[model samples]
Target: MRISVIGTGYLGTTHAACMAELGFEVVGLDSDPKKIEQLASGVLPFHEPGLPELLRKHTASGRLRFTTSYAEVGAWADVHFIAVGTPQKAGDHAADMTYVDGATSALAGHITRDCLIVGKSTVPVGTARRLGNLVRESTSGDVKVDLLWNPEFLREGYAVEDTLRPDRLVAGGDSAAAIDLLKLVYAKALKSGTPFISTDLETAELVKAAANAFLATKISFINAFSEVTEHVGGDIRVLADAIGLDNRIGRRFLNAGVGFGGGCLPKDIRALQARVSELGLDRTMRFLSEVDEINLRRRDRVVHLATEILKDLQGRKIAVLGVAFKPHSDDVRDSPALDVAAQLFNAGADVSVFDPEAMENARKRFPRLNYTKSAAEALENSALTILLTEWDEFKELNPTEVGDIVESKAIIDGRNVLHVQDWLDAGWRFESLGRRSV
Candidate 1:
């Protein structure tokens, strides 16, 4: 099946290329001329492992192309996927549906043949049903059009692997024709044993929201335990391991460290709450407020620890490792690491930041802080060092080498990945979020 994907941001760009890899002729559309030009030139605007090679191969082979015109892809492709972003609305917890609505209307106005329009963007439940009506009303009815909500379950660092080989696939629409067409599109994955979930629109939309809320809750649950462990003399990691040992309570996101932050988790949970409240179910998702509170509190704990260690913040050279929310990708939206680094900078500390891939994006967001070329540069001559994001390079650093660089031998393990005894043996004062400092 031929496919056209809207929005060339993280999700769309990856989907477009992966569709081409699955042997479908694909066209990726974006309103931004700069982004289209970059993608068309085989340059990825963001960091995602294994995506660049796919984009280059497909574009070079003419299986994947990019354009800024909806009319072009409208008459050409049999399916159009809406992979646009649904970022949190400013001054509100609800998702801003402006982009999704605009993309749907644009395609509805221009689609020239019978096709399926898939909603890959996360949204409030019932959005698919609502958008189905909007599509029927907005379209000229020159062709038969079907709508489906196929929520993407892509993790940032592992987006490519997730897309090409998903653990499961969910498609929500009432039309059998639309479902069949989607099955054809994902036939390879289906043949490879990827579970396909067929359901109604609301359930499909809720899956994404519910999944994010649960993951956020899991991370906050462990961090909440870390808070207790921080006050009392108990090992938070050990507590997590003991509980996670249960066959039911798997050790996935139970790490006790700086809490979850990224484009997905923080906004998705808040948006889910706001959506339910709009339906007058205010108290239904009330606990998510505490989830958010716990996540934000993790950042506060880091800043407070930094202040306590430095004694005085003014003019203290502080090294911050890993400004991206997690690792392997350059996304910094609602990133816990970046938030902590920014807070430290605002608190009058000279915060030098380093991330393997996120420095460019981090610099764009917080230009006032120092962006270092390497982790070593950030550590040099610093009074204190903080490891926020758990990148492999940051986790593998030698304690003795880091000890020689920093002016004062003090380090904070924000992610709880380091060996506490090793740092202590290096003659450095070490502190972690849920551990007794030494």
Candidate 2:
């Protein structure tokens, strides 16, 4: 089947390349000519593991292409997946639906043949049903344009693997044909016995929101416990392991560090709360407000710890190890690590930052902070060091080697990846979230 994916961002680019790998003719559509040009030449504009190889291979094989014109894709493809971004609105908790709406409307106007329009973007609930009506109203009567919600559940670093081998598939729409088409598109995964969930449009949209909310809640739940352990003098990691052994609470996302932050979790929870409030049932998801607060407070805690350790932040050289929200990806949106670094800088510290892949994006976000070429460069002669995102290189740093470079040997394990005893043995004062300094 011919396929077209709109908005060649993180989700769209990965989906389009994966679709091409499944042996379909795919065209990725975007309004940005520069992004389209980059993809057309098999150059990924962002950092993702294993995606660059796929893009290069597919583009070379003639099965995948990219374009700036929606009209080209609208007339050419049998299925159009809307992978546009639904970023959180500015100064509000609601999702910015401008991209999703604009893409769907453009596709509806330009599609000349019967096709399925699937929504893969994480959006507020009731968006698909509402857009489904928009599709019906906006499309020409000659073509049968239908809408479905098939929200993406891709982890940034593991996006390629997750796309090719998803845990499960969910399709929501009334049309059997639409579901069947999606099944065909995902037939490779189904052949491997991946479970398929067919539900109403609203249920499908909520699956992404609900899953993200649960994860954000899970992270905050543990961090809230971390707050207790911080005061009561207990090991939060051991506590997490004991609770995770229950099987009811899995070990995933139980790592209590600097709290959850990335493109999805923070905004998704806020969006869900905002959505419920707009529906006039504001009390339904009120707990999420606390979840958001706990997450933000973790950042504050790290900054506070730094201040206490340094005994005065002014003119102190601080080294920030990682700025990406999590390791293995360069996305800095709502990144706790980046936010902490910015916070420290604002509080009058000589902050030097380094990330394996995120320094460019981090520089764009916080240009005033000093960006360094490597961890060693950032660590050299610094009074304090903070490990924000737990990248493998940073995690594997030898305490003695790191101590030799730094003027003062004090470290904060923001992601809980460091061996506390090892740092302590190195004669460095070590601190971590939920752990009392010895």
Candidate 3:
């Protein structure tokens, strides 16, 4: 099968490479010429653990290629997957549908033969039905051009694994042939016991948003409890573990940390709320606003805790460990760690920031903050240290070794991953969120 994936960002690139890995000829399409050139040259612009290997493997074997022209893929491939971004619009919580809309219309116009045009991007509900109509009006009546919404459920850093061995596959389409053709494209996954969900257009679209909203709610729910535990004397981690022991309540996303961020959770929940409000159901998803606020407050809690740790911020050198939203990925969009670093920097604290992989991207976003080579370099001669993102390096950090490098013996475990006794045994002043005050 010949597969063409549009939008060579994280989602599209991973899908294209994985499809090729499944022994299908795949061509990834991106509107940006530079990105296309980079991918074709086997140089991925972003950081994903396993994707780079797959890209190098597929591109070397000639099973996967990239292009900037939609017409090239339009005329060549048996399947077209739209994986463009639907970022939150500026000055609004709603998702910007420009990329998805343009990609659909352009692909619909250039498609010369009967093939399935699958939408893999996360979008507002009812987008598939609307785009399906647009495709019908735009295409000639001669060929059977099928439009299906197959929203991607990829998690960053594990995108390759998720794409190659997805837990489930959901397709929202009206045409049986279109849905069946999609099954062929994902036949490898289906044969491996991946559940296939066939639903109408709206249900498929809502599934992604609803999943994101629930995840965001879960994170915020624990963070809200973290607020209470921070004020009163209690162990938030123990509280989480106690509740997580229940078979009903899972132990994932329950670690009270510096809140959820990245390209998906923050924007998706807000977009879901905005979309519901647009449909005159303002009260339906209003709690998502609270979820958003709770998540943001976790950032503030870090700032306030840092301030309390270092009373005077001006001219104090503070080390910020991990600026990425999370570890194993370089994405800093709406990152709490970056935001807290910026907040500290703005308050006249000299911030030396470092992350395992996100240093370059963080530097691009916030250039003025001091960027360092390693975690030790970021901590060198700093009055206080803040661990925001829970990267494995930071989590398993040797407190005694880190203790000797800092100007002062102070640390804040924003992600609540540090061993309190270990830091204290190392004779360093240590504090973590949702723990008894130091």
Give the poorly placed runs of model 1, Cα more than 4 Å off.
Answer: none
Clashes by residue pair, model 3: none
Error of 2 at 392 (Å): 0.7
Off by over 4 Å in 3: none
- Give the clashing residue pairs of candidate 1, or none: none
Alpha-carbon lDDT, every model: 0.94, 0.94, 0.92
lDDT of 2 by residue, 1-438 (tens): 999999999999999999999999999999899999999999999999999999999999999999989789888999999999999999999999999999999888888999999999998989999999988998889998878899899899999999999998888999998899889999999999999999998899889989999999999999999999999999899999999998988888899999988899998999999999999998999999999999999999999999999999999999999999999899999999999999999999999999999999999988999999999999999999999999999989999999899999999999999988888899999999998886
Native-to-model Cα distance after best TM-score fit, residue 375 in candidate 3, in Å? 1.0
Q: Order the candidates by lDDT, highest first — what do you get?
A: 2, 1, 3
lDDT of 3 by residue, 13-123 (tens): 999999999999999999999999999989999999988899999999999999988788889998999999999999999999999999999898898888889999999
Task: Mark the 10 consecutive residues where model 3 has the least summed lDDT.
Answer: 429-438
Error of 1 at 137 (Å): 0.9
Error of 3 at 294 (Å): 0.5
Estimate TM-scores for all models. Answer: 0.99, 0.99, 0.99
